[model samples]
Target chain A: AQSVSQHNHHVILSEAASLELGCNYSYGGTVNLFWYVQYPGQHLQLLLKYFSGDPLVKGIKGFEAEFIKSKFSFNLRKPSVQWSDTAEYFCAVNRRTGFQKLVFGTGTRLLVSP
Target chain B: GAGVSQSPRYKVAKRGQDVALRCDPISGHVSLFWYQQALGQGPEFLTYFQNEAQLDKSGLPSDRFFAERPEGSVSTLKIQRTQQEDSAVYLCASSLDGGVSQPQHFGDGTRLSIL
Candidate 1:
């Protein structure tokens, strides 16, 4: 079975601090990678996605993720995070060839304290 | 208002009761999917449909859970004889096409609490 692993379960940082959440998947095929963010009371929103082409993909809200195929990693990163950026982030993936269901990793809860 | 919508933002039911959750995908979305998110966890795939055709249901936990998109638009997920373990947030997502490249947009999930 395909699985995703998120190395961090909780992270705390002061405002303006850098952010990096690690994500790795165990699938040996062409995969579509995504990062979704959920505010305290909001639905999951697409942050970034990588299908093909450039491995570096930029997303909304100053978020970007790099897909390192050799490492099987698609880590989310932000140069500087604001208090409002605190939320649960999820990394998901699916096979790139078909209409496949997304396999998500255990979310990482980040708290940005001002 | 063009995003996917889910009805009954919250629901509470007895252990043995039956419950239904509805999902209204974005207009003209050909692929609809259902997912279950436990507390403090990521959303897990439950099932998906490609224009009223059930393509994959392998993610469903058990036979008690059933989902349908009869008109290739609105979808419903029904759970019979619900158990306490069924408590979770049921999320619905839709994409313009069933192809692999399209990004799925999600709806505010229906939080189900079984007592």
Candidate 2:
């Protein structure tokens, strides 16, 4: 079975601190990468996604992710994070063809202190 | 437009009881999905439906789990003889289409607790 690996289980950061969450997948086939964020008591929301375009993809709230096919990684990054940015981030993937059932990593919990 | 809506934000059932959760996807969405998220774990795919057709049931953990989308809009996930391990949040997501390009939108999952 294909699986996603999120190396960072939990991360603590102060306001304005940089953020980077590592994500790697075991699937070698063509895949669609996505980042989803869930704030406290909120449903998961789309952060960014990588398809067939440029590797560096920007998403809402000043978040971005770079898709590296050779490495089978799509890592999420932010130049500066705020207290409001504290949430659980998930890395997901699905095949480019056929059923679009997402395979998700365990998730990285980000805590930003002001 | 309203996002996906799930009924019974929280549910509690006895170990041998049965429970049902509901999901109403965004209007006109062509795809609906069910996922189970255990504590401290990411959501895992349980089933997928395209319109009224159930195209994939491979992810379902067991035959005790059943899902249906009779009219192709609303979906229901039911589990029989719930066990302690069945305690988790049940999430429902929908996409405009069942294609790779469309991102799935999730609802506030139904947190189920089996006693």
Question: What residue pairs clash in candidate 2, if any at all?
Answer: none
* lDDT values, one for every candidate: 0.95, 0.96
**lDDT tens digits, residue span A1-114, model 2:** 689999999999999999999999998688999999999999999999988889999999999999988899999999999999999999999998897899999999999999
lDDT of 1: 0.95
lDDT of 1 by residue, B40-59 (tens): 78999999999999999988
Residue A51 error, candidate 1, Å: 1.0
**DockQ score, prediction 1:** 0.84
List interface RMSDs for the candidates, in order.
0.9, 0.6
Q: Looking at candidate 1, what is the lDDT of residue A47?
A: 94
The segments of candidate 2 whose C-alpha lies over 4 angstroms from its true place after superposition are none
Q: In model 1, how many backbone clashes occur? A: 0
Summarize candidate 1's per-residue lDDT along A12-94 as a digit string, tens digits. 99999999999999997789999999999999998999988999999999999999999999999999999999999999999
Grade the docking of candidate 1. high
